[model samples]
Target: MANQASIETRDVRLWYGEFQALKGIDLDVSRGRITGLIGPSGCGKTTLLRCFNRINERYDYVRTEGSLIIDGHNIYAPDVDLIELRKRVGMVFQRPNPLPISIRDNVLYGYRLHTPKAERSRGAEDEALESALKSVQLWDILKDRLGDRATRLQLEQQQKLCIARLLPLKPSIILMDEPCSALDPDATAKVEELIRQIAGEFTILIVTHNMAQARRVSDECVFMLIGEIVEHGRTEDLFIAPKDQRTADYIEGRFG
Candidate 1:
């Protein structure tokens, strides 16, 4: 079967006040695969990632134009529910920002919010917690320390916990913005491996300044410059033989 697009954008544009951050971007992010967005700082990669969940709207002056569809739904449709949309599209930030609550609580936070108290049972909650942690490869290490504060965990584990928290919500797509930027080389590699392991189950769009990390973890790559996508192709093709001179220059380290 042909691969399906999990998210599709047609002439998507964003403006923060008078500054246009994204300029008529059209791209299709494949389902069950990892798509990497790479560019220098302020290139709008992160802004595009935030658009998937409508998080950019948090800014009062921000305005978006064009269509952004996720899993066949036009996210900007007037009837769409923001809460439900966020539940379907989760985001992980650059640094590990676990709440000071217990590890188990952190993992179950979204689950509890989306699910009513009457619908939640002890066994179901336990199962959900274990399943989420296991999916992120954190179950074995933190199983016995579920009551410990999440912020006290190591940076890598805290980051993984942030990802685990999202799984219970069963998000259709996960947006990661510079997810490993705050980690060391070793921690970054670990997180990258975890990301690869989870790719087939969920559509992932990750923004990373580290080109090597993008090549290692993503199935396809999108290169952007000055608020627009310059080139996008399979990871190997985009890196080895870019169709655009600008893409070749960026990949070859001529300029960011």
Candidate 2:
């Protein structure tokens, strides 16, 4: 049976002032699967990803139209609590961005935010920190250094920490935008492995410029061009036999 959609967009359009970045996109990202959004830099892959948690509206001039639904709720509805929405839909950026704090603090940041002070005791925080770190495969390596500064860790570990930090929030969907772009080849491979390890536990929608990464890490793929989705399908089907000529050309490196 097909997986239910974790995120669904219907005729979703976005604008930064007057410039349309996303033009009436209709897409579905399946629950507990990795979905890759691929396109050139100027395409709307990142824009569409940001719409999930309404992060695009952070820019004062940004505007959006149509429905962006996540887990059966329309995220754009006025009654929607942005904080709660963000808790359910966490995001990781292009580069590893750990805060200037201790490793334990970083991991517990989101948990602390959503949790009340009286309910958040040392024991609970410790358990959450350990669990989150272990989920991202960082516990063994960083357990002894919980008090160490997060920014001082290796890039790979830092990136993992960024991911680890999200787990405590119990997110339903994780949005990653070029998550490994800042890492070296070896680090990239390791991060990809980590991403694969965490799949099926959370719905992940990743935007990547690396076609190979998309193929390796994603179960499904989306191809966009000029602010439109050209094609979307199972990863193997899309890569092996793209239905759209534009998708084929781009995949074959004929053009972006």
Candidate 3:
């Protein structure tokens, strides 16, 4: 079946000075579906994720060769506006790194990043912030005490706040790098539920080490080895009956 591509990587290659990180990788991300990137450490999952935001381009030694298209625009092109690109493709990291400010402050950070000081309105900002918290199911828990320190919230609440923080921008896609890695089981479940609720609203690409998590949340799965993709297919087919020996071995827990 042909999936509508929300993001695509065509003959993409990455290098850190002379050392190559990604080897002519080709990737297709389905619109409004979850795509899981599973591979051992340093196999380039995070590197590839960073590419979506042109985060790789910021590093001095890093150089990219090929096309990364998002919503039909060649993002790797010379004139792509990186600031705007990031606003459209938001990211959540492995750790829940909330700001040292109030919960409301954390959620408004992205708005501040994209909106100019001259154009930003206090009322508009508040409305956007509240809407974001609601989207992540965090508004009720945080609504009463918007002025309290962000860290005062429970760890789970804080993580959701971090997610809430990003949602205000209404990004078309979200890149999650091991988002539930640091949470307890209950917190993890909450995060997983949030994923299900938000998947259809935003195109999501996740990098996870947990095989079960991949099977649980992903619509499509990509398995990589030594910086090269060994297999890519529908999550059910890949997990139930992977065609490649390496993919089968990795998923079977013989190797990562």
Candidate 4:
């Protein structure tokens, strides 16, 4: 229960055309915790994150191997449904990409898409919208402005809205790819706090280039290099006493 893995990868490998992006990754992400993936550019951290929801398969030349299991299901199995998988494993990108529609519409878009028509009454939709916005601490500020265009909101508000939009789908896992990278220092701190507050309710896997951020937000950390994992351990231990020299060197700023 408490210690079980929500996401597990066994010797997972991936390639984009002739280029290998991931090479034999084996990892387990604990349920109801924050696991951060940190490494230099081109380290395949983001590639690995996208694998959880099978988004990387969008490219025609992209190919993957091995098993990626979420809960007890093998996501790469031929019978797996991509839409349902995505709904269960939501993603928040580096930049805020809210829709150009009204704020209320943006928050309810995913709900409307996945929910049955009979269950999408206006009162139900409004309730879902408020709950989602409150989860992201946006309800207070945006409650009266539901009809405003979402894209016109401040970057921080838009980013929070993007996360709010995912809640109505009732995802069990949340994947964040440098979610705070586009925000200012103040905004980044706020979003990091928000992530920490939501950790116990959903499994979170975040890809970050900022070592400091990894130290700050993650309960566990995985360090990767050139498509291969170098070290995986508790964040405090890994930062204080990394067993591998490459991990130590990278953390010490000796090399990227």
Q: What TM-score do all the candidates reach, one by one?
A: 0.98, 0.98, 0.94, 0.99
Clashes of 2: 0
Expressed as tens digits, the lDDT of each residue in 1-256 for candidate 4 is 6777999899999999999999999999999999999999999999999999999988999999999999989999999999999999999999999998999999999999998998779999989999999999999999999999999999999999999999999999999999999999899999999999988899999999899999999999999999999999999999999999999999999998
User: Could you tell me how far off, in angstroms, the CA of residue 82 lies in candidate 3 after the best superposition?
Assistant: 1.3
- 1-256 per-residue lDDT for model 1 (tens digits): 2376999899999999999999999999999899999988899999999999999998999999999998888999999999999999999999999999999999999999999989999999999999999999999999998999999999999999999999999998999999999999999999999999988889999999999999999999999998999999999999989999999899889987
Q: Across residues 1-256, which tens digit of lDDT does each residue of candidate 2 receive?
A: 2466888899998899999998999998899999999988899999999999889888999999999889888999999999999999999999899999999999999999999988989999999999999988899999998999999999999999999999999999999999999999999999999999998989999999999999999999999998999999999999999999989999999987
Candidate with more favorable, higher lDDT: 3 or 4: 4
Against the correct fold, how does model 1 do in TM-score? 0.98
Worst 10 residues of 4 by lDDT: 1-10
lDDT of 3 by residue, 132-229 (tens): 98888988777889999998888888888887887878898999999999999889889988988889889999999999999998999999887788
TM-score of 2: 0.98
Ranking by lDDT: 4, 1, 2, 3
Model 2, residue 136: distance off in Å is 1.2
Task: Kindly report which residue stretches of model 4 are placed more than 4 angstroms away from their true locations once superposed.
Answer: none
The per-model lDDT (C-alpha) reads 0.95, 0.94, 0.89, 0.95
- Per-residue lDDT value at 147 in model 4: 100
Residue pairs with colliding backbones in model 2 are: none
